[model samples]
Structure formats: C-alpha cells, structure tokens
Target: MGNRILIVDDEWNMRNLIKIYLSREAFQLNEAKDGYEAIEMADQYAFDLVVLDVMLPDIDGWEVCSTIRKTSEIPILMLTARDDVKDRVLGLNIGADDYLIKPFAPEELVARVKALLRRRKKDNREIDKLLITFNDLSIDYDSRETWVKGTRVELTPKEFDILYTVAHNPKTVFTRDILLDKIWYSEEFRDLRAVDTHVKNLREKVRKAGLSFNPVKTVWGVGYKFNRPEDQY
Candidate 1:
C-alpha cells in the first residue's frame, strides 16, 4: 500500500483539491476538517505525512502541530494564506516541517509534499541499526527512545533525531548547514541558530535525567560531534 497522508483543512474545496493532486501519486489519503479532528485522527491512526492548513475553525494549525509534536514526528506541510517570513519562521519553529503560502501552484504543493515524504523515508533508512550507548546515555533508534541512567528521557522528535544523528557518527563534526539539511530537509529556513537551540535543549534534558556526561560536544569554531567522556576536556 502507498503512504497514508492526512489532509487537514476547513475548506471542502481545499481538501478536495489536495486529494485530487495527491491521488495522482497513489497516496492513501484521509481528511479532517478542523484541528480537533486532526489531532484525534493523528492519535488514532498511523500517517506518513500531514498537509495541514494554518487556519481552522477550532484549535488552529499551530496548536495542532504542537500537540502532534508531543507524540509523533510525522512530517507536516503547513499551508497558510500569509506569506510573511515571520509566519513561515513561526511554523518551522513550532515543528512544522515545511511551509507553503496559500494560492501556491499545484505543482509546488505536490513537490513539497513529495520532498517531505522523501526526507522521512531517507531518515528511516539512515537510522543506526544498533542501539547507541555512551556513558549513561542510551538511544534506541528503532524504538525512537532515549534513556539516561535507566530512566527514559522525553525528547521531542527533532531532539531525538539530532542526538541520534550525531551519536551514530561518533567524533564526526556536523556543521549547522549539514544538520539542517539532514533533519529539516530544507534550505529556505537559514537560521542555523535553530540547530543550536535544539542541541542545548537536548543537553539540558539529558543532564536533568541524571546523565553524568555530555555526549554532544561543540567544537567552538566548528559544529558539533559526539564525544565520549574520556575524550572531552
């Protein structure tokens, strides 16, 4: 079966339009008219991607996206009528993977959807096969879980991906741009600070969870790498 995608929009015409275009790609599609429905459906079903409209009659897209991020890492393509850079940045910051302004070309929409899906597949394919353990930190790629000293640490999807990517390639430096490509899969959002923010949050979480060592080490002039306790200064 093809990938299952949920299309969330309040407009009947918009939902039908997205379905029409996505149908050509042979994706299995589902629909929700408002934020509550979207959240409920997301919890009840396993979907590969979500095409979410920012404006809704109920909870709005940002809230829905934030709620979903609490539980799942499914790719989200945010649709908005506003083309402001602030809006786009807000979407990305709130965990939306991709952004598309309203009145966008049909082909662009299709392209962005395909791109996000491709990124998701590539992430799955590149996950480390073995469980990664360093010091008291343990990361299980298959289970998408992290543990510090036997206590499970709650990490957001992005935080988990960043931790896994660096930890899997121990001692290898990954520049901000590289991580952005690997995780966000888009060059449009050029704020390298986003990567820094996630790494900082990750470190704090691991520390708060009782981990004795910091696994993610920054190289000062360069990017970040996974360093064993003995290797750090």
Candidate 2:
C-alpha cells in the first residue's frame, strides 16, 4: 500500500486542494476538519504523515503537535497563514517536522511531504543497527529503549534520539544547531532551546532511574557532549 497521510484543516477548500495535489502520488489520504477530529483520527489510525494547519476550530496546531509528540513520532507538516519567524520556530520546537506558510505552492507542499517521508524511511533503517553504550547508560535504537545503571528509563522519541546521538559520539561537542540538524533534519529555522528542553527531560529521566551520574554535559558557550567517569582516564 502507498503511504497514508492525514490532512487536518478547517477549510474544506484547502483540504480539497491538498488532496487533489497529493492524489497523483498514490497516497492513502484522510481528512480532518478540526483539531479534535485530527487527534481522534490519529489515535485510531497509523498515518505516515500529518499535514496540520495552525488554525483550527478547536485546539490550535501547536497544541495538537505538542499533544501528538507526547505519544507518537509520526512526522507532522504544519501549515500556517503566519510567516513570522517566531511561528516557524515555535512549530519546529513543538515537534512539527516541516512548516509551510499559507499561499504556498502545491508543488512545494508535495515536495516537502516527500522529503519528510524519505527522511523517515532512512531514519528507520539507521535505527535498526544502532546500539550505543556509555558506562552504565545504554540505548537500543531499534526498540527506542534506554537504560541507566541497568534500570529502564522512559523517554520520548525525541529525547531518546538526542541522548543516543550525543552518547554515540561521546566526547564530541554538538552545538544545539548541529543536534537539531542531525535529529530534526530540517534546518530552515533553528530552535536551540528545544535541544535544551529534551536534554533536561533526558537528565531528569536518567536521574529518576537511580543513576548517580549524568552522561550529558554542557560545554558552556559551545554546546553539549557526553562523557563518562572512565572517559577521564
């Protein structure tokens, strides 16, 4: 079967237009007119991507994106009439994979959709062989599982990726922008603070797992790097 995509927008004409453009690509398309319906559809179905509009009758797209990120890493392509830099950064920080301003070309939207799906496929393949360990911190990429001090640690998908990326390259300093590029893969706009948020969550989770040390360290004015006690030797 072709890729499944959900289009969430309050405007019928907009949804129809997107459907028309994507119909030529063999996608199994679904539509939701409001954020409420979007969430319901997302919960009930496994979509390859979601084209979400910022304005909705119920919850806004940012809220929907944040809520979805809480449970799923399904790629989101956000649409908005606002082209402000802050809005774009906010969307990316909240977990939208790509952002398109309203009045965008249909061709551009299709291209972005294709790119996101392609990246997702590549990422899945990469994760299958990923296993990184630093001292007592261990991460299994395929299962998206992490352990610190031999105890399981729960993490959001983004958090796990951030941890794995830094830990896999221990002692290597990764600026926030570099981390975003490596993980998010869309660099049109940058959100350095988002990296900090995930790192904070990762550290808290590891701490709660009874681990006595932090594997991730800030470089102060640079970025972040992973280090272990034995790395000192």
Q: Write the per-residue lDDT of candidate 1 for residues 1-233, one digit (tens) a residue.
A: 99999999999999999999999999999999999999999999999999999999999999999999999999999999987899889889999999998898889998999999999998876664458888788899889999998999999998999999998888689998889888895656657999999999999999899888888899898899987878877
Minimum summed lDDT over a 10-residue window in model 1 is located at: 124-133
Q: Write the per-residue lDDT of candidate 2 for residues 133-191, one digit (tens) a residue.
A: 66677789777899888788889988988888887777699998889888885745568
- Clashing residue pairs, candidate 1? none
Distance from true location, Cα of 117 in model 1, Å? 0.9
lDDT of 2 at 59: 92
**After superposition on all CA atoms, what RMSD does each candidate show versus the true structure?**
13.5, 14.1
TM-score of each: 0.58, 0.58
In candidate 2, which residue ranges exceed 4 Å CA deviation? 131-233
